[model samples]
Target chain A: MNADPTRLLAREMAARLRTGETTARALAEAHLDAAERQNHALNAWLVIDRDGALRQADAADAVLAGARRDGPGALAALHPLLGIPVGLKDLISVEGGQCTAGSRILEGYRAPYDAHIVERLRDVGAVFLGKTNMDEFAMGSSNEYSAFGPVSNPWDLDTVPGGSSGGSAAAVAAHHVPLSLGTDTGGSIRQPASLCGIVGMKPTYGRVSRYGIVAFASSLDQIGPFARDARDAAALLHAVAGRDARDSTSAPVPVEDELLHLPESDDEAVAWLRGRRFGLPREYFVAGMDPDVERRIHESVAFLVDAGATVEDVSLPHTDYGLATYYIVAPAEASANLARYDGVRYGLSRRLEGGDFIADYLATRGEGFGAEVKRRVMLGTYALSAGYYDAFYVKAQKVRTLIKRDFDEVFASGIDALVAPTSASVAFRFGARMTDPVSMYLSDACTLPVNMAGLPGVSIPCGLSEGMPVGLQLIGPAWSELMLFRAARAFEGLTAAATWRNLEPAQLAEADDAAGPTPAERAAALAAAR
Target chain B: MAGLSRSDVEHVAHLARLGMTTAELDRLEGQLNHILEQYMKLAELDTDAIPPTAQTIELENILRDDVATPSLPASAVLGNAPAREGDFVIVPPILGGDAG
Candidate 1:
């Protein structure tokens, strides 16, 4: 009770609750206070439900109090999530809560029902602190496309936290929440996690249900978690991944306890990595990337070498076609998924000065969508239009087969997981990647191909690159969450030697700031320019 | 050659049911063409025999028992509609035929 719950991990906070040292009500209140203080500057949260969160916390406190009558053993059964404040990326619906997905098209809209994950979080006792901001309809990489506002990285305010899960990752990095959920279509979660200095993982596609998630690109989209460490990410994933009758794509497999297998000591962790073979794709280390980012990724790879991993070069040859293929395929699916938002059903609808149904449709869509959303929807519509289908969508899918094959060949060669940089550069200043659509698409270069192949990839912070964090991505073949988590935990342990244990962004942002608002704090200054 | 003309964009916009102004159409025409120019790279790959992957995992029609389960009540479903009358969402008059 003497310590600030904000300083502890979700699991640690839960441990204190188990001992009755603090109540969920107190922890939730502390998080709400932190969110209020930082949210104005960071733009991380879109909606903060203090009353609803407190009500949930009160219910959790009651559960804990009832269990305490039995003993510590009974309290342990309740787990640490019992009252832990977690942020949901705006895209994920929380029944009766606003679910805009950062687009004006859905402005003023509220979710009618709980998403599968929301239902799961309710059962696990995690409190819904608020909704985090994101790229409008999960389209852009900078988080600037959000109709609400851009989420600034806690490490440097001027730089973006990456997108479309920028707000979710930034909130966690800012310590507004110890954990938050984000959906990744094309590095939406991992890329932001990398830029913000946190851990994020995209469960193998279909590993988590997408029933209540506003669909962007159905085939590539996935919901994952952002956390401070591997164990918390694993725990959050466990709470959400399961078979749901509502989502036909939900995997029927069991959610294996990946964290239970983590080594308790550094020596054991290193020994665990010694048996595995890691692959580094040459394409990922290409020129034009930030040299500091490149250096940090290789440094982490070297740490893997010290752990006795056999590192070798591999080729995912179709990587060059990945961005192009994704642009085609995603928009094609997005065009279809977005068709339901025609003003008649729900969301913002600008009625034209006419009675024609067609005019109403045009006015509603044209006015409601943002610049980036319109660009993508148009691109997808063009690709799927008659006479262009074979040359575009079909060709992109054929190229997709080649991309998946590249991974298949590497895994066939006995490489357990592919280790590479999660992003090409650290978080860039606002408007850095905004000017050129192609440049913005290139931002997802390192992470998108994994989605193309339908593989599971995890982005874990390795160390600092010129003070900005570098994320090392570990990718495993289909259904390799266990192996991916094990290796990432090993690398996360190696970071301890570099003082990474104290690298929480919210804690570091205070001291890391100097001269005006640290580079990370510049977003607040730039907001006036917009 | 790949860039769309104003009319081309207008036609496509109509197909997509988006009402774009001259400024937006002109801007999007250039941007859309620029994005499509990138996809020309897919032509470099030879996929003569390969089939397009429609879904990532091989899927069969998922059949559940043809039984009804509890569904969301009309109230919760209609709660988000911008303009609603009774259980149905109200749209502008469709057959009136003329612009105001």
Candidate 2:
């Protein structure tokens, strides 16, 4: 059977696979074909495991055939993510697969075991589509920090896809694959999803397992998914979200069926929005916001209000300090987490004639880490240094508490979730934010507060701003992913159910030209110009 | 709110066990100072009355039962080592070097 290019979402693909309308090999071939055609120019994917993916597809088809032969007993073996081609961030280990974490230091290392989430996905028959690039050690707000080279936004190749998770976002938005996993520590996933015009979510800190993910900030990092819409993201999350003994911090809370409970009709979705209260944090709409972004964020809020939700002007008093707090906390944790990369251990090691063990250690890290990674390591070292811990690290932690309090106070007073812009602007041209570090930090201004509070937030594309995608963010208190997903589903069901694929960033406007005009179309246009 | 000096960056880099070139040190001195200068905004708030939150969730001292479980073999653990001899990692001489 012929497949519609635009209708290849993970949920739809799985349903078709279960029915025998399409085979797993067929689905894999289509995505692999697109990935091969699009990956070279996009640079979103770090590696494409074409052979491994097709092998997995063969296994999935066998499983489907087994189900067909065994009747209901075998149908019970089906999973939401079965037969789906999912991209993994370079930071997540895949058991003997190359796991780079986008740093030269880890480039030579291969993982010996799968991360908790990877194991979960693997158990359910999910197909791996190889690793995607990321900001080195998840330290930058733009993909430019990657030692492997930056991933260009598919919207405009001259611009950057927002970082740490930029590669995963671009892969999904460009239609190379239907879904990809991303890790968020201080807005990494949501910010990129915004810039790339797709759906990305970061569950409440402990809501997902972090067992084999390369540690950035132990307290802040959480892995989630990027997809074409909220439904697919929820389905992917359902596959991976659960408690794990390997991750000491994984929450014991049960995962809910948010995707299954979603409203079936637009009126029900509007009614679903009716009684929920949302706060528009005043500080998030600061002078630093781009004019187009500000306008689009307001439009998103107005859309919610028109659908029977109440939007209020709320104060997250310490929202302004979240950026400063994250800079200190994330780096301090990173400095500690990265301390294992000595010459005696795994990864690249540099040796010099006069240098002893310590010198060897210094040289190995110096040669292995990129400039941004070094900058954060030094900053963190200083923050936690003997004389400055109280003034810097402790103070940052206190502000972090205040940030959490702001969210708690609002949520306690009956607000369901918060609404805000995902970033200060849209996808920016390369080298735009790199000149000054502080300006680059400002890009996470609106999204970092959620991490500070251990809250779940989802970014769904609202509209285009300045010819690029802009996202509307929904954030809720701890273990509240179900609520956030419902709200996102409501908003998506209203605006995107009928026309989203056409409305997204990657394959919309200039793609036809980039894909290069069909010969006939080019000829007709040239003839018309004459 | 003050910027870091060249010596300050050198000291921090040394503490972090990162060997830096003169050019990298020079460039980082400015960028690190700019970043720290931005972080100075946090000093403006009065956090004296508040307790610090090292983690957002209230989790501490997560204890596991004392039991022997299967562990990764030595070869798997050492598979990614850059330099190893007979299952033991090899390093240079330990004495006569600046301690990190």
Candidate 3:
């Protein structure tokens, strides 16, 4: 208990809780205090439920006390995540709480019931600190598209924490919480984790049920975990992943128990890396990649080679077509999913007296959605319109097949995983890519192909590039999450004593200053300067 | 793949049921055209033999038992309705009126 509880990993905190050195309530209080104090500058959280978190923490404490009284068998049956604090992306439903999904359309809407993941987390006795900010409808690469405000990276207050899971990434990166949940459509989780310097994984499609989570691009969307390290991320993913009868798409594959017990010793973890074959996708290192980022990735590959792993250059031939294919497919699905937001049902309603329903629908959606959302909806509608379906929507789907085949061929060649940079560049300043839509989309170039292939991918901090964190991504074939986590854990062990591993977010002290300018103020000042 | 014209943009917006002002439409025309240009890259690949992949996983035709379960309370479901009466939500007239 002598160590700062907020700084300890969730696993370390679990160990503390087991030995009676600290209670769940104390850990929750420490995180909530840090979140509340730092939120003025970070703007990471949309709402921090102080009362609700404490209630959950007290419940966890009671269970811990009872298990202690009931002897060794009862204690052995407890979940490791019991009493851990977690941040949830605003898109995930937590009953009776606001689920805005960062859009004005859902500004005041409260979820009627818990999402499948929320139910799972609650059953394991995890504390929900609050909901975090995100891009509206999970549409943008930068958090600036959020109607509420942008999220500032903990490393540098001037730069963005990548989106649409920016708030969750920043919350974990800033030590407000050890773990969080985020949904990835096309690099929403991995890109943000790369920018914020944390661990994020997008489980294979249908690996995690999406029963009550907000729909972004139905075919591509998957909920995943964000944590400071691979083991904690693996633990979070294990708690929520598996079959759910409600979501027909949730795969029936057995949830692996090995996720809960990743190799703890350095030697054991490194042994998993030896003799593993990794494919370095030549296409992932594109022309616009920052030299600093390329250097870090090469250094990481060399470290893997030194540990008895083989790295070879590989080609995903259809990789260039991935961006265009994803843009069409995701938006087309989004348009259909978003068509439910008419004036009558649940969200914002803009009906005028005696006005036709068509006008009402038009007004409600037009005003409710932000610029980026409207853009996607417009593109989708145009593509799906008459005389364009085959040329756009159907063509994107066919191209998607080629993208998947690229990954399949590489994995078929006996490659255990594909190693690549998570993002082409480090976090950029706010208002940097805001003006050009294509530039914003390019932020996810290196990571979106995995989503297209429906494979599991993880991003872990490799090192710093130009004083900003660079992420090394490992993508594996479907249902290879256990292998992916083992590899990520091995990399963590390999780089444990590196100088950059000891570094914390540079601007965290500034974020803690009460008088500092809020993210909204900084955004406005930047706009004025432009 | 030609760029969308102003009238085309307006028509698509109408189909999507989104109200757009002249300024919004004007900006959207350029933006949408730029994005369509990006989509033009998909044309470079000849996927005539490739099958379209709508869903990535192998699981399909998932079915469950017909047993019924308790549903959400009507009160909770209706609580979010913008305008509602007892067990009913108010809506604009769908017939016998000018559509716009």
Top candidate when judged by TM-score against the true structure: 3
TM-score of 2: 0.94
Global CA lDDT computed for model 1: 0.86
Off by over 4 Å in 1: A504-530, B96-100
Model 2, A490-510: lDDT tens per residue?
A: 887667553433654644344
- The 10 consecutive residues of candidate 3 chain A with the worst lDDT sum are A352-361
* Predicted complex 3: CAPRI docking category: high
Q: Model 1 reproduces what portion of true contacts?
A: 0.82
Give lDDT tens digits, candidate 1, residues A187-270: 998999999889999989878999899999999999998998887888888888878888998878788865544675767666
For the predicted complex of model 3, DockQ is: 0.82
Clashing pairs in 1: A156-A520, A157-A520, A157-A521, A157-A523, A158-A522, A158-A523
Q: Give residue A487's lDDT in candidate 2 (0 to 100).
A: 92
Considering DockQ, which of the candidate structures 1 and 2 is the better prediction for this target? 1
lDDT of 3: 0.93
Question: What i-RMS does each candidate reach, in Å?
Answer: 1.6, 1.8, 0.9
Q: Which scores better on lDDT, 1 or 2?
A: 1
Enumerate the candidates' DockQ scores in order. Answer: 0.72, 0.70, 0.82
**C-alpha positional error of residue A79 in candidate 1 after TM-score superposition, expressed in Å:** 3.1
State the lDDT of candidate 3 residue by residue for A1-530, as single tens digits: 44789899999999888878999999999999999999999999999999999999999999999999998788778898999999999999999999999999998898999999999999999999999999999988879999999999999998999999999999999999999999999999999999999999999999999999999899899999999999999999999999999899999999999999999997899888889999999999999899999999999999999999999999999999988988998889899999999968799999976767888998999999988998999988888888999999999999999999999999999999999999999999899998889899999988788899899999999999878999999999999999999999999999999998878898988998989899888888888898
| lDDT agreement of model 2 with the native | 0.85
